[model samples]
Structures are given as structure tokens and as C-alpha cells.
Target: MPSSLPSTLLFLSAGIFLAITGTLDAITFLAVIGCAVCSLLTITERTELAYIGGLALISISLILQAVLESKCITCLKADTLILAAVICLTPFQNFKLPAQIMSAVMSVVMFFAVVTVVPVESESTDIKPHGFGQYLEVQETSGEKLTLNTAENPVLLFSPSCSACEKALNKVMEQDADGTKWKLVLSSSKEKDIKKANELLKRIGYTGTLYTYDWHGSVPIVIYTDENDSTIVSHSVDKTIPLL
Candidate 1:
């Protein structure tokens, strides 16, 4: 077997993983194709070109994460794997000065393109003095409405297509949350998203009340309101789950 075969397989695997877990956005889809092309280049002994492609892929991944504030663990894992593939191909790289300069230029262009083209969601700036009550009210007017239990102090904001949300929900299922009345809020109201959310909840055996909201912020958000009237909002699964 060729020594480059492992690197080729690694590149292919990272691409497939991203395709499966990532949203079908233009950037993500193009990245997947880039990975496939890189793998093919590696197999064909064009390691220099493959290495340049790997660098561009890494740049795109990091740029998206920074711009989107995405908390998708699956996307992160795929990026890490792509990095590994790039490292594996490093020893085989032999770029001339002109080629190196061109690669750098290309990366810069891709960076600007992603930043300009991707639509960013604007977050709500209003403070919810009534905590979950405000969320319920907004949902009633714009999205799905649900009755919140007065006793339930924790609310989880998530999106069906979010990898971090799925991980957070899985964590909740694995632990002891028996007495807690948890409220699940979906950030999107699209039919496909709702269908996927319901399927996820059913698979996890979650019996909590699920609501939909027109949320603009990054998700897998956990809101905990203490008895002292203090509201704590957590964005990551690790920070959010411990508070539950």
C-alpha cells in the first residue's frame, strides 16, 4: 500500500463527516468538495497541491467558527481531523516561493469571501426582566407557544440541526434530572427543523414541554433563574449542564 494512502483516507473521512454533520450552506458544501479534491491530489502524488488545499480548508473552518460563533462539536471534530490530515501531508509538501505566495493570496481571498457572503443573525438586545415569561410571550406572538411550569427554573434553547444541542440533550438524558421540569425551546420554526427536533426528543425519551422561538443567537443555550431573581445564561454544554 502507498504511504500517502492513510493521509488520503483521513482527508476523505473528514470531508464525509463534515458533510453529514454540517448545514448544507454554500461554504460547508464547498469545503466538503475541497476535501475530496485534496484527497484525490494526495493519492495522485500531488502532495504540494493537497497541502495548499488543506491549509485553505483549515482557514475556512476557523473563519466560520469565529464568524458564526458556532458551538457544534461535530464540526469541531471534523476540523480537527482535517488538521490531522494536513499535518500528515506536511512532510510531503515541496512548494516553491511563488506557489507559497499564491497559496497565501488564495487563502486571504477565501477568507474575505466567506466573511462577506455568509449572513449573520442579529441577536436580540432587549433584556428579559421577566425571564422565561418574556420568552413565552414572544413565542406566543411569533412562534410556538407553551405553558411554562412556574416551578421549572431552567430553560434550554436549542436548534434541531445544532450538533451542540444534540450533545447537550444527550447529557441531560444520561444524568439524573427527575424532579426538574425542564423547558425545551426550539430556535427555528421551519417544518424540517421541527420534525427533526421532535424525532430527537422522542429518541431521547424527553417528556418535557417543547416550544419554538424566533431566537437569533447561537444555541444550546441554557438559562437558569435562581430564587434570588438572578438570571444566568450559559452558551456551552459543559457550563450549561452543571447548572441544571
Candidate 2:
């Protein structure tokens, strides 16, 4: 059996364990200890490359532990047990030095590596508020005579044909904005399509302004108006929200 293969396997196992557990834990600590044992064994056998390789494995393990944020107690227990086992085996060879000293050095290096490179904190911001400047102006269609009040709050449009648009509209419905004023303008290029849309809205019991024959239905564009329904905030196609 090749002696180096065991160390290689140990290193691979340590990497897999760290990836699953994420920053710190008992497993990572043990892996560091195992590397030191392998290193000492290689050193006594005059296998300098193997010794270096073992130390490298230990270093890598420590780095992973540090990155993952494993607890010191767990790491210490693992290191001590593995080093103790290696020291016991060192007596069989004509070694100049005990494994204890080498193990101690490797452990210290691992601790420093973790402390230096801490995990960065990440924050998530809602995409809805990024470009949400003002409320869109949703007046009644040319045929419809209802002049609905514009809700000072944000409103997203939803079309019937698009399933994705329906899902987004559902989310808006669930959102807590009972006091917020909103109007849905059902626009269709064809008169029949507009009639179908009105029928669907009526069937679903949606009490909002219905607009038909909207020639300017560019889609996903949020409209912003001033106090006097004069100017627009901006005309943009927001793909994140179905504002068509």
C-alpha cells in the first residue's frame, strides 16, 4: 500500500466536509490534526517531499476551517487526538524529533489563517424599490368614463394572456396595501380582445378602472405623474415587474 495515498484521501475528504458544513465545525478541526500526523510520519521516514505535502494538506484544511468558521474547541479536540496517535507511532522509527513539536506548529498556522480571512457579510435589497420613483397614471380607457384616483403607492400592471404576469399580479394582491389606490387598465389592440378582458375581470370580481383600445400598449412601462396629471416620471420597461 502506498503511504502517500492515505494523506491524499484525507485531504480530499476534508475539502468535501468543509463544503457541506460551510464555515466552522468539529469535522474541520479533526482534519487539521490528521494532516499533522501524516506530516510527522513522512518527516521521520526521510520523505521530505511527503512531509511538505502533509503540511500543505494541513494548511489547506486550516484555511477551509477558518473560511467556514468552525469552533476552536472542536478543532482543538481533533488536532490533539490525531497528534497523540502519530506520536505513539513515531517511536517505531529512528526519528530525530517527536511528532508533538510538528503538530503544534501546524495547529498554530491553521488558527492564524482562519482569523485573518473572515467571511464577508452579504445583504439582500428588494428589486421593487430600486427604480420605483412614483405611482403610475392609470386612467379609464377612451370608451370607459370612470376617472379613478391614483394610489400614492406603487402599482404593477398585469395582462390576462401572460401566466407570468398573472403570478406577479397575484403577489401584488397579497401585498398589504388596502389603503393604497390602484387601477388596472385592460388594453387590447383588438376590440374583441378588450371585450374578453372586461368579461374576465368582471367574472373575477375585480373593481378597478377598465380601459379598452389602448393603442400605446408598449408593455411593462411604469407611469409616474405629478399632483396635476401633467408630467411623467419616466417611461421605462421594467422587466422585473409586469407593468404592461
Candidate 3:
């Protein structure tokens, strides 16, 4: 019975580490719990430690989930509950198979309880919008140097053919038809695509300025800058088009 101290400490430390660092693998710990359940360890006083381990594992799973922010985190929570039940009820050394089964059930419950409390882009404006403004590379119909040396609230909107980019562009164009404050830059790598991008200007009726550069795989990049603070918001997925 006293020997269960080390195991409890180990499990507790693991749970706490998981909660803080959000890096421990809950599945591995669950597997450990499973092995203990199927073994003669469940019939010993040390079985209680396994239940504690289950609780700790769940705590770790939830803490890491909040920090890491992944869609797969729910799976971790579910699996931990199942293993915790085994630990809670299997500590009865004399109750035979029924006790072990009960342990399994309680282990699952402990798993659920630990997590029940912790309910806590992509074209991402995630990217700092920079270097997309190549206004010097632009040329008008009269071969005049199209420069944005004096435009107010100059917003450089870059996009390819991504649906998110398309949606963002449509929103920008719909709101700002004259394209005075918004600069839509079609990003493309292929030569044929550049020619197609030229039509985008005509489609938008943006007589103000048009700029193009070799697309380096970053679609829907928006850069908003002023004399005071420069803000770059770029993303490959759905994001707010801030070129207005």
C-alpha cells in the first residue's frame, strides 16, 4: 500500500507537467493505465495509483489543449476518460474480477471528471504584410509611371485564386469601386496568369493604380501602412479584407 507513493507521484507530476507545458502524450499514459488494468496490479493496493495516474493524464490533456489549440484535442479527452475508470475501482485487491471491472468504470469516470472542469490562418492576418507593395513595377495605358507617392490610406491587397482570396477581393471591390484607397494586387507565378490578372483591373474598374509581382505562394496578402504605424495582414485562408 505504501509502495503506491512513487507511482502516485509519478502520475501526479506527469499530469501537472501536461497542464503546464501542454506537451505530454495522453495516449501513451492511457496505454500505461490499460496495461495496469489487465494485470494483477489491479488486485493490489497500488491499483489506486493507476486511478490517480488516469486523473493526472486527463488534466494534462485539457491544459495542453487550450495552449496548443488543435482540432484533434477532443480525441485526447475522450480516450483519457476511458482509462481513468480502471484506476479508480481496481484498487480493491480482494473484490475479485467484479472489483476490477468496477475499477475500469471508475477510471473512466475520473478521466471524464478531470477534463469536465477545464472546458477551455492561414492567409492569416497571421502573416505580417510586407514587401507586397511593388508600386514601382506598375505601368499605365500611356506608359506612365504609376506611383503611389501621394495616395492616402494606401492599402495593398494581394490575392491569387483562393476562394478566401476571391471572397476578400469581391468584398473590397464591391465596397470601394473607384479603387482610390484600395490597391488590388493580383499575385501570380505563371506568365499566363499575369495576363489574366490584367483583366482583373478592368473588371474592378479601378483606374487608380495596378501593381503585379511574381507570386511567392502567399495568396491574399494585405498591407496597410501610414506614416505612423505599418500593419501587414497576410493569410492563405479566410480572413478579413482590410484594403478599404
Candidate 4:
């Protein structure tokens, strides 16, 4: 076989491999390997050197892609691969300019997509009743006060932050069983949150007790008591509570 024939075969194989797999995964990373291997083979004088460089490029690209997806590297592996690939081509004067440009663009877009899909963190808003023993004193809202000293009806423990609490509140209001008095407690950790929950309750015409700024440790819990303040029912404001 002629010297030019081997180089031609190398370029053809690399191109075919890239065409099949490049778009199947990310076009950017795979294309870089394909172009690098093809370029090294077509330009380098020695037959052994061309074959060795192509094999090395494939290995490095595969390893880099693995680390990128796994996030095992310090910086994202995709970014590192792009940087390394550009550096490798810089040493060679005859590189495919268009192929390198496309790979760079694709890598950036993939990174942006990954960032958009990641979940964000939020702070907890459960209000736990603390120091209640001090404020056990009965206070009246809207010139109406229910005695918390006796238990004549079932209590519904609720929190504004809890989806279950909202559903439960709706049920008690719309589907009252024999119009029995159901004590409502809006459990919230912050006074502002409790106040907001109370406003919502009021908008829904809920005449329940609005307990604000009460927390036990880090957890927030709300207690619902009968008109006489006995037979308390408690519910914790947590993520696991299901909506009705």
C-alpha cells in the first residue's frame, strides 16, 4: 500500500466514527477527538506516529467525557476537554478551523442546559410553637375570643407553608360535618409568615386561631384545640405531609 493510502484510510475511519457517534452523544466532545485524530494522521510524516496519536486522542476523549458527566474533575470535564483540544490544535498549523468552532459552540450550549435543569435550594418556613407557656394568656382577635380551656369539638392543626394544611382548611370550611366547630391553628416559625397565613385564613373566612412566631427548636408545629382549649390536635409543618 502507498504511504498516502494509509493516511487516507485513517482520515476516512475517523470521519465515519465521528459522524455516527458525535450527534448521538454530544457533538462537541466527540467531534474534537475525530478532528484531532484525522488531522494528526493526515499531516504527521511517520506512519507509526499517526496511528499512535489517533489512539491516544480517542482514549483521552472518552476519559474526559466520563469525568465531565460524573463531575469528578475540579472544573467540568467538558470545559477541560475543550481547552485541551484547542491547545493540541494550536501546536499544529494545519487544523480544521470550522470543526473546532462548531465544537466550542456546542460545548457551551450543553453546559448552559445542564445548569438550567439543576434543582435550586429553598429555606424552611415551618413555625414551631415555643415560649407558649408565657403567652398562654387568651387574646381576642376581631373582638371575638374562644375559650381555650375546654374541649367541645375536634381541632385542625395547620400551617400556611404546608400544602396539606391548605387542603385540610378547605375541607373544614366547605365540607363541615354537621357544622361542628373545628379549631384552626396556623403554625409558622416567623411572625411575618404566621401573620400572612392568618390573612389568608381570614380571606377564606377562617375564624381560627392564628399562632405566630412560635417554633420549637428548628421544627415548626401548630396545635388546634377545641373551643374550650382542650383535646389538642397537633401537626408538624414538614415536607412529607400530603395535600388532601
Could you say which candidate leads in lDDT?
1
Error of 1 at 91 (Å): 12
* lDDT string, candidate 3, 95-131, tens digits: 5576667555655655554444222222224453344
RMSD of 4: 19.0
Q: Which candidate ranks first by TM-score, i.e. highest?
A: 1
**lDDT for each of the candidates?**
0.65, 0.41, 0.46, 0.41
Backbone-clash count (model 3): 16
Q: Which regions in candidate 1 have their CA more than 4 angstroms from the true location?
A: 1-37, 47-73, 76-151, 175-180, 236-244
Q: What ranges in model 4 sit over 4 Å off?
A: 1-147, 176-180, 188-190, 207-244
TM-scores of the candidates are 0.57, 0.29, 0.37, 0.29
Residue 33 accuracy (lDDT) in model 1: 94
Of candidate 3, the 10-residue stretch with the lowest lDDT total is: 116-125
lDDT of 1 by residue, 1-244 (tens): 8777887998999999888877556776888899899999999988888877887777777676556544444555666666667667766656555555655564465445444322233464223342354234325323545565423546677876566677777777565344255667777666666777778777768766667765655567776655665565656445445555
- How far residue 10's Cα lies from its native spot in candidate 2, in Å, is 43
Model 3 lDDT, full chain set: 0.46
Against the true structure, candidate 1 reaches a TM-score of: 0.57
Lowest-sum lDDT 10-residue window in model 1: 133-142
lDDT of 1: 0.65
Weakest 10 consecutive residues of candidate 2 by summed lDDT = 118-127
The deviation in Å at residue 139 for candidate 4 is 4.6
